[model samples]
Target: MSAPKVTVLDYGSGNVRSVVRALEHVGAEVTLSAKSQDVLNADGLVVPGVGAFAAVMKGLKDVDALRLIGRRVAGGRPVLGICVGLQILFDEGVEHGVRTAGMGEWPGKVERLQAEVVPHMGWNTVSPPEDSVLFNGIEDERFYFVHSYGVQHWDFDVSQPMMKPPQVTWSDHGGRFIAAVENGPLSATQFHPEKSGDAGAQLLRNWIGRLGKP
Candidate 1:
């Protein structure tokens, strides 16, 4: 079988080349696309973002990426988000006293980590849930993180029977923040998997493998 065709949405906010290279290294036929339709039709989609929340949202909006992601995810397609890309999946983002609306795929807010030292840079280990597919064999390894803002908590309605609880991963700095989340067809990581070493490559491979199923 041919490698899964993956597209890294180019919304003018993230490390596009690095993400493309990482996905390619992990056995994906990756394309960097600025087109919304390409994102809608990809076998797997990656939204990678770096920098501020508001800025990234603006870039996504410019290309109608938020709608594309929401529509694709609602249809049960596989979508992976990285760093600020993951942050924008939440309801809103509070940065520097300003709150910007996110895509609202999940109920939560992205805020600055309440740590003495901002921008949690370098490697850190994450505690993944018992049945996480993304962390398959690399659960014990460390992943690279470089961000000050993160989703401090998860908010989901337990009353909704159809909504399965997400497989969550946690990591600590001054306090604990969401390291990764696997919710059905949607997955995200607060850390930079592309910057992470062998462990990160494995994580990407694991995600890619899922794209070939069903």
Candidate 2:
């Protein structure tokens, strides 16, 4: 019944500070992993992205980190991806670079926003992924978002879900990006939950509550 050990991957995305503070506030033994060793050993991991997709992927590659991350998650580690971090989980993204495949978790591609104005910033609505535990104790509402691209939707391997939920698969990362997607022990958020005020805090706290001791 003690706090969980959580690691926030700080790749210069700028939101790790608040996430770390918030997790610690919730009694989590939080560690900021800028080094590969820290990252590979984390009980739970958070991948934060605050810049362009190509650059972010390059940074992860520079350190050969995402494969290690994939290994951990594949081993049943609870992992979370936020914003751009969420987008890169797909098979590819078209931001600033050519068609580059992702870590291949979500099995989709990232693309530039269809919005006339790039960088879809501000508060936006996020639909819950039907019984998403990450949404426990939380009301469905608007969350802060600042991105030019998002997860182009993919059909979940329905045969494998512990539960099924409703979703819209737009050409743009499955119709929308919200809340978060659940694939095994992996949950990803395309919006910045850390900046979503009370709702955001509840979202994060719920996520920590769902983790197991490593």
Candidate 3:
């Protein structure tokens, strides 16, 4: 089979090269595009970001990438978010006392981690939910994380059968927070898979495999 065509959205934030290299290493034909239209046709779209919430949102808005993500997701297309990429999928984010609206794909807000030490950097084990595709073969491994803010709790409705509950992975520093989430065609991770070494590679492979499925 041919490599999956993955687009690493470049909205002027985050380490786009590292993400491109990592995706290429995992059997993906990667393209780093700033154009919003590129994401629509990709087999999978990766939204990677680093820096403050409002700033990153501005970058996304500048390139109209936020609308692209929302449109693709609404069509049941596959989209993956990394770090702040994951955080912005929620309703809003609060950083340094500033509240900024997010893409609102999911309910909740990104807030500062309650940990004594901020920017929860380094490798940490994740507790993946049962039947998690993102952690299929690499559930026991650790992934790299570097951030001071995150979604402290999941806010999706679990009572509706039509809206299947997302598979959530949890990790902790001072208190538990969302590590990863798999919701239908939408998936995201609080950790940086591009910097997580071999374990991260396996996770990418899993996601790539999903891209090839019907």
Candidate 4:
């Protein structure tokens, strides 16, 4: 079979090249583009972001990428968000006491980590749910993180019959916080899998493996 075609949304967010390179290394035909059709027609879409929450949201709006993301998820297409990309998937984000609205794919708020140390950097282990596809073989391995704010609490409750709850992964720095989330058609990570070396590569492969599955 041909490799999966994946689009890395190019909305002026830094650290995108590494994400593209990582996906390529994982056997995906990666394209870095902000074109509407490119974002919509790909087998998978990756939204990578760095720096501040408000700034990232602004950049996404500038490119009208948020609407495209919503449409993709609504149609049951797969999309992955990394770093600040993950943060903007929520209802809102509060950084440095400033509040910014998010895409609201999930209900929750992203806030500063309660830990004394800001910007939880370097390698850290994650706690993936048993059914997590993203952490398949790398369950006990560590991934790289570089952020000060994250969703400290999970507020989502599945109300539909036969609908499964999202698989949430956790990690620790000074306190426990959300490390990753796997909801149908939508997934995100607070860490940078592209920079996590072998473990991260395996995670990307795991995600890519499920690109067209029901």
Candidate 5:
């Protein structure tokens, strides 16, 4: 099969070059575009963020990406958010006592980690659920995390009889926080898979592999 067409949403949050390169290395026909057509037409969309929560939200708004992402997910198209990209998918984020509204896709808040160490940098292991496609064969592998804030809790109820529950992956820095989430067409990670080397590559591959599935 031909490489899956993936578009990396470029909204000026920075640190996107490495993400684009990583996707290309994983056999994806990647396009770094802010065009609405490009964002919605691709087989997969990647939202990469590397900055303060408020600023990232501002950038997304400037490019009209919030609506684009919502439309994609609503249509059952795939979307992957990285770092602050993941954080912005929630209800809101509080950084240094300032609260900013997020995309509100998930009902939660991103807050500063209650850890002794501020930025929880470096490699860390995660506990992915058995049905996770994102962590398929790399469950024991560690991914690179470089953030001080994350969604520390998950409160969304997926207990309806017909709907499948989301697969939540957990990791601990000062306490247990959401490391990754696989909820239908929406998936995200607090860590940077592009920078995680081989293990990260496999994780990205796993996600890319699910691009065209029904």
Candidate 6:
């Protein structure tokens, strides 16, 4: 009954420490690192970033982390990304291009919400996706979200099989906007689960549960 090793990427993101603390709070043997090897060796990886996508992208590249991330996912290691980390998994980002282009795992664009004030920040409702391991224990769950740019055209790039992939579960926010997505061992969320308190802690547990190695 050994605790699982979970590595949280600390690529100079503002909330990396918070995410590590939260993961530890949920009993994960958390390792915080800016190193690619640490991520590659871990049983699971969590990428949490807050700030300009371009800067985050550069940080990842500086340490040669993106290649490791790609290899890890390809090699069957479970992975998760939060907030901007998830947003950049696509092809392009239109928010303050301090950093541009995505890791391109999922396809889409990140754009500022017009007609409404940018940077929607606060707690909002999340529609549960059936069989979502990330939503293992929750109801009427409202988590903290802070961002000006929201996802658009996610379904277009996401393969139909992947969109409905047996392993890919989703939490829908705006019918089309993907709040959370899971592909096999990899999962992501646009909300700050660590800042969301009890429910956030629950999310950590749920993802850990998917490791299948107790």
TM-score of each: 0.97, 0.85, 0.97, 0.98, 0.98, 0.88
lDDT, candidate 2, 1-214, per-residue tens: 6668888886666677987887787677989876777776776788888787778888788767787788778788888888878888877888666777688776667877666666787887665645567776564566777787876456657775665443431222224543467666687788887788888888888888778734
User: Model 1, range 59-147, lDDT digits (tens) per residue?
Assistant: 99999888898888888889999999899989999999999999887889999999999989999999999789999999899999999
Model 2 TM-score (2 dp): 0.85
Worst 10 residues of 4 by lDDT: 155-164
Candidate 1 wrongly placed segments (more than 4 Å): none
Regions of candidate 4 where Cα sits further than 4 Å from its true position: none
Native-referenced Cα lDDT, model 1: 0.92
Model 5 is weakest, by summed lDDT over 10 consecutive residues, at 157-166
- The runs of at least 3 residues in candidate 3 whose Cα sits more than 4 Å from the true structure, single-residue gaps closed, are none
Clashing pairs in 3: none
**lDDT of each prediction vs. the true structure?**
0.92, 0.73, 0.92, 0.94, 0.94, 0.77
Tens digits of lDDT, candidate 5, 1-214: 7999999999897889999999999999999999999999999999999989999999999999999999999999999999999999999999989999999988899999989998999999999999789998899999999999999999977777897777789999999999998999999999999999999899899999999898
- List of clashing residue pairs for candidate 4: none
RMSD (Å) per prediction: 1.0, 3.4, 1.0, 0.9, 0.9, 2.9
Which ten-residue region of model 1 has the weakest summed lDDT? 155-164
Tell me the tens digit of each residue's lDDT in model 4 across 1-214: 9999999999999989999999999999999999999999999999999999999999999999999999999999999999998999999999878999999888889988889888798999999988789999899998999999999888787788787788899999888889999999999999999999999999999999999999
Model 5 residue pairs with clashes? none
Better of 1 and 5 by TM-score: 5
Candidate 6, residue 170: the lDDT equals 34
